[model samples]
Target: MSAIPQERRLVTAVPGPKSQELQSRRTASVAGGVGSVLPVFAAKADGGIVEDVDGNRFIDFGSGIAVTTVGASAEAVVRRASAQLADFTHTCFMVTPYEGYVAVAEALAELTPGDHAKKSALFNSGAEAVENAVKIARSYTKRQAVVVFDHGYHGRTNLTMALTSKNMPYKHGFGPFAPEVYRVPVAYGYRWPTGPDNCGPEAAEQAIDHIAKQIGAENVAAIIIEPVLGEGGFIEPAKGFLPAIAQYAKDNGIVFVADEIQSGFCRTGQWFACEDEGIVPDLITTAKGIAGGLPLSAVTGRAEIMDAAHGGGLGGTYGGNPVACAGALGAIETMKELDLNARAKRIEAVMKPRLAAMQEKFEAIGDVRGRGAMLAVELVKDRTTKEPDPQATAKVAKACHEAGLLVLTTGTYSNVVRFLPPLVIGEDLLNDGLDVLEEAFAAL
Candidate 1:
């Protein structure tokens, strides 16, 4: 897939002179609101590594927040995109329809969870796809209320901001979110007050009861969830939780939407995360890794539900750009050719054992959970109380960055260090990144 030296080579102090200069320039030119996990600027990125501006190379543990599953410079993705670029960049799919768009939609229908007759609508990002899913659901049911879970993250748009659960960075000070959005409890096993064993059915029953008592199921339009919660940490809800919710959605005629922006593709060791639980969502919103780093998203759903939207009701200016569609086709091809689902499982097989060993040595690591290439360790001050240790999490991430490894921090409480390495990463490189992680914990 790549010829780039799959090694971590630090030629200078991390965030070295060139990167420091770029950061200064960025401060002046870019908005303060825009943030970065690492301050060093990327010079070039390939398979498993990123060479920063200072000539230092880093093992990429975060795949641009789980976007580049086929790697940054996958040959198939590049070839397809370059071919499309020469053919046509943009005529706007809405203006003059293209085969690439139809091809991408067809691919999604085949790949997404269900076998029932499916249709798709492409968009530019995950948020747009999610917002459109809500539109389709509401149009179909003539209902408005949308239900989401505790650790769920939809996006940053007004309605999605309401769907998202975080406060400080995402929703705070941004007053006046969209209405008709309700929040329910997520089956976070580690944080469940009762216990991990009871989290699944108990949390599901609690959520179902709340909806029935307060926001009557009959009035709800959609119930959106992430099979593996992303931004609110990689919390895989207790096993039976999703099935219960999906059944409730069915019984109440609520359109169940699976937001698979981060966990879609092969990141979760399956074509889609919901398949592990056998819960077929009525509609699924996908982006991020779907197009091998290109900005392409889609809402794929049952034909009857998708057709509810009128012809003019959906679509945007650059909803499915030709080049992006080609990139998606290439990405899907790479997924199939490489058998990335097995690769993802292999990554988990390699990573979980190493991560478990680290936890055995460090009490700060309270929990290690996730599936496939998407994995994380939740930091806490005490194993008993399980109080989040955000300071320790920050220090560990900073240490990894300083040592020429790129890692990311996420969680509702900001105490989880998430790893989303590229599936094509060499074993030696992945282990090297994990070695740095172990060292960071030792230093703490």
Candidate 2:
């Protein structure tokens, strides 16, 4: 890892000479389909700081898109993974099996929502976990259709793209998607046609009724949704909305799968966002924070539902690699030892107020919402109209990035500025990042 302090220090500029050189090389080698949010190339990242190839350091508010909740290069994770690396790399659980994979499954079964007897199957990414979760639901329910909410983002795979709601970047030109996937309205408080007060029940009724009338609930395999929509702007569904949907799925015998990939692993001040509403989803898909930046994802659910899949029905070559499993165990240990959940709540306590203050000053900040460290501000062209201002949002994000703060933008409309600082980030550094955000707004 590069030698750098926790403080944000810029040597030459945002994307310095070294990063620029690497960017030019990337243009020649990397494909156009892959997007780089910022041109800065990272050499090392620890805690809340990412040291670029140019030796300039930035306070990371993206957490590698919510992958490094325990912080990139967390000591526990590195140590454990190192030990596993020295011992052995891959045995392929199906081929010979390993204790690490079983241990991770045990940990996931305990950590994921619900007290009911639960089981888990490991995978390589959030998209794969969601794909397997859908498989499990279908095998258990004997159904073909999968229901996803408006603005909900699943993944980039064909099946997941079919489940995803966005088109421009995620689904556009991707073409002929998988079959039997349905999309419905989400209880997005800010954008609801009626007021937020009416969003919860109304959206739930609309979605449930649509399924009942159009797809026939009996044919629905699962209802998959992000507890707090990640890529689609950190829109936390209106209160009672999630529980109502879960209940409706329960009544209909449809598997309710909570895609807590970005919101799980203590990112939302709770182990999983579904726990905020005491929701015990039939299956929960997790990935981003599960292995402290290592590529690990899981589909944990009620034993009966999970066991419905036959032997050899799930898993990939790299699924639950021993080293990654070790990293997950270490990350889980770190979360418990440091009480990162409390730290996450503390982060929200510090950030939401600052963002609200910004909202008071900037009319473009039409809405400030989200929970714990995963918060965001929806940018709009008009307060009452709530017309998305993607241009202005991009401008402010560029300003922040140029100034050394790594804030991310999201939303179906591409007009939400998000803050996802690491849970282990010091209060001072968190404040500094927020200060940069404040300046970005002032510039706008």
Candidate 3:
């Protein structure tokens, strides 16, 4: 049986009676530091639709920040996790290792797009995965300094924040960040030192030369990057960029870490986005969609590097929760059975034309970029000037929300509208969501 209810209902306003009541209670009880996106509370979700407490059903384009690739409330994930609940929940892998944890790790080792011997470690979030990957790289290389690219986002943890480049929201006053983290320019074609249309091997060469000259690669432990940058604006490095970086890291004895937290698990038309360029990173950090909406993350990489850390030093209290592992098993099986990679390609096919047409029609659209289901439309004042139109972007986002669609806006400038629909969405519903976007643009 489908996990969603038979019908959707919206008897009152979008926030309606129940949501407003909850909002009042939230204001009273919750800490002021907590923030919210849409005011509507989630009642249930399935396929690519989120039903709010007031019964408003909206087409989901964000996919819970790209975490529910198998769709929220996927049947297989629910069933597997429910069955595993009958077995047990937490054993704290450090205290006592469990088969479920090992099983999930084994799956990751096999599936993370590498023929080399690999080992896997599980954690609760992308931040944890990134931290652990850093730990592994530093331990294996016995180096102190790490190099990150400009506009890259690792996570929100203090160490990851140091690894992250943006400062306003993520690092605003969160001073005393971790030490030995260096940031350099990313090969972002849109705003690179060189022009957009000039992205090629030369761009990669320039960045690498700067890194070598400035950081003196010998002191760097790892060069962590996103195969396709996520919060930095869905920017894909040029054709020769990833390979060049990988080769540079290899020659310098620096671990090449692929932060696939937002680009793995078939979200980018492949098992991992780096695979598109045949770049096999020494370490890969992944989360978001790994467990079909469950809180699970993993760091998979060369067995030697992963094993460099001491045994008791690696796991957390809830590192590989049994339920999340079961969910992951089901999620991976669902991906294989459904061919979500092919689905992502199909989504790209639909989104590219629609977004390209919008770029032609709207003066605010500066760029249409990204891969597969992971796509974005960058907003600007004028195509030629490329001044960010944050106000117009906010208006369009609000319009889409009011019109029964859940679109997400992101970017270093907060002016890019990103689309991350669940891979399971029907093409017709997907098209309808795109049409809503068009209406939003028109209203803006």
Candidate 4:
């Protein structure tokens, strides 16, 4: 059905002459701060394959960092977005509101967790949505302090950088970040100090205690966390952790915000990862996989909290662009039509076992974890010590790229090789990508 061939094909060496030429051009034009995972320039992409300028077709395991759940060139997305584009490009949602924007808001209200009356406001990126969510929470609760977890990545913006834990690339040199942001411990099972068994209750109690004593829970506006930590090595917080935190927020009148940017919209075997624990957030920020590669993010939450912000308080010039809204609607349609949640579960079923088997053979693999297509393997220098092996992570990623499999490396320690294959990726292609990974590990 798709025009682009699904099979991987390598007509030339990875990053061949053409891509090398492009790289030279990019170096001259693009900013040095902007980094790319791979140097292979894409000529075409569809399903699970990205054909490069040099005729090397690589299996896409990163899904453009979990943005394309329904594939890059999904038919419904193209059709609806093209039709909307032909009709009108932009009037700006604020000046002249359109049905597409409202339609998308309606869809988000119905899809996101919670049966309560909900409302949504759209934005250009996840950072904008998160920033806006914080604004709304502050306005509603009349509080200033916000709580975030360690190893949780909200975005690149100043406030989000302060909320984020990583210091090297994210927060390095980006000084004088926004004030009133508090950091707390996340129930990271693999690296929890007291061990995984007590991680949930112990970490939650410590985090709550610190917030109550240090920041004064009464002054806290919000407690934001990723349901499944993304750039932090796909770490799923230990069981009972989220619920405990949510309850604490509720009791303290603090807004419980779930940053579902990378884990929402069927990428995590459910509509939202927060649903896995039946934890209902006061506000949920979503972006990455919402619009089939188009830039669109939203802050969906309780109607009362959302309405706390004045009419003119929330919105940007390009927020909720019609074309992006159409893409989102199309993406939602594709998800329901294709049953992508089930597909994500199936991906997990296939990937986790293989990763576990790899761990059995390879002592360097400290942990294999993640839900659905959002999976990862944390590399370590020694299994006993669990010391991060960022060098091995880099080596394995480079090997995968050379073999025409696109994978991504992440984590606070930079020792996590994360897999975020498109939900539409065929099983054969998925296995091929994993095969490339196994070979990389073996060679390492």
Q: Which pairs clash in model 3? A: none
TM-score, per-candidate, Cα-based: 0.99, 0.99, 0.97, 0.99
lDDT score for candidate 1 against the true structure:
0.94
lDDT by residue for model 2 over 1-444, one digit each (tens)?
A: 323588988898878999899999999999989998999999999988998998888999999999999889898999999999999999898898999999999998888877899888999999999999999999999999999999999999999999999898999998799999999889999999999999999999998888999899889999999999999999999988899899989999999999999999999899999999899999999999999999999999999999998888998999998999999999999999999999999999999999999999988899999889999999999998999999999999999889888989999999999889889888889999989989988998
Q: Please list the residue runs of candidate 3 whose C-alpha ends up more than 4 Å from where it truly belongs after superposition.
A: 5-11
Q: What clash pairs does model 4 have?
A: none
Q: What lDDT would candidate 2 get against the real structure?
A: 0.92
The clash number for model 1 is 0
Per-residue CA lDDT of model 4 for 101-205, tens digit only, reads 999999999998889999999999999999999999999999999999989999899988888889989989989999999999999999988889999999999
Q: Model 2: which ten-residue window has the lowest total lDDT?
A: 1-10
Stretches of candidate 1 exceeding 4 Å from the true structure: none
lDDT of each candidate versus the true structure: 0.94, 0.92, 0.89, 0.94
